[model samples]
Target: MPVITVKLAKGRTVEQKQQFVEVVTNEAVKKLNVKEEWVTVIFDEYERENWASSGELHSLKFGEGFGMKGIEK
Candidate 1:
């Protein structure tokens, strides 16, 4: 069995998460040679304040409502 963990700042919609899971699971099933039922996908969501990069907190760097929308290009 393959256990995949995805960590990201919170605020992604259910649809987005579902889409991500479907794609990731399919990839895992093919690349890892694991059955769909045996593949496990987990999400570890965190607040913007708790997540930091470049020595700056996302909340301060991106500001409010950053979440998934903030990282979009």
Candidate 2:
């Protein structure tokens, strides 16, 4: 069995998370040789205020760095 946990800021749509889970689970199944039924993926969504980068609160300072740029594409 393989267990994977991913943490990200909340607000993604259901479709986005579904795609994420599908891609990750498939990769795990292929790389780890785990059965699809034995692979588990958990997404933990946090508020922007609860997450940070570059020592600044993510909600307040995320746009100034590569954060917003990465998401734009």
Candidate 3:
């Protein structure tokens, strides 16, 4: 089985995750020569505060609740 792990800042909808999984699964099946059923994908979501780049936390750099609906800017 092919296990793939993707880590990203949390703020994605189920639909987005579904779409991403579908694409990754298909690619793994095709390029890795694995069966669709044997392909496994795991999402490791993180808070923006936990994710940092360029010595700055994403939460502090991009503001809280980026891309999430109903969140105050």
Better structure of 1 and 3 per lDDT: 1
Tens-place lDDT digits, model 3, residues 1-73? 8888989778788999999999999998888898999988898988888978899987887776645532344
Q: 39-62 in candidate 1: lDDT tens per residue?
A: 888999888889889999888877
What would the TM-scores of all predictions be?
0.85, 0.79, 0.83
* Superposition error at 59 for model 1 (Å): 0.7
Q: Say which prediction, candidate 2 or candidate 3, comes out ahead on lDDT.
A: 3
Ranking by lDDT: 1, 3, 2
Best by TM-score: 1
lDDT for each residue of candidate 2 in 1-73, tens digit (9 for 90 to 100): 6889888777778998899889988988898888999988888888777877789776676543323533453
Regions of model 3 farther than 4 Å from truth: 66-73
Task: List where candidate 1 sits over 4 angstroms from the true fold.
Answer: 67-73
Best by lDDT: 1
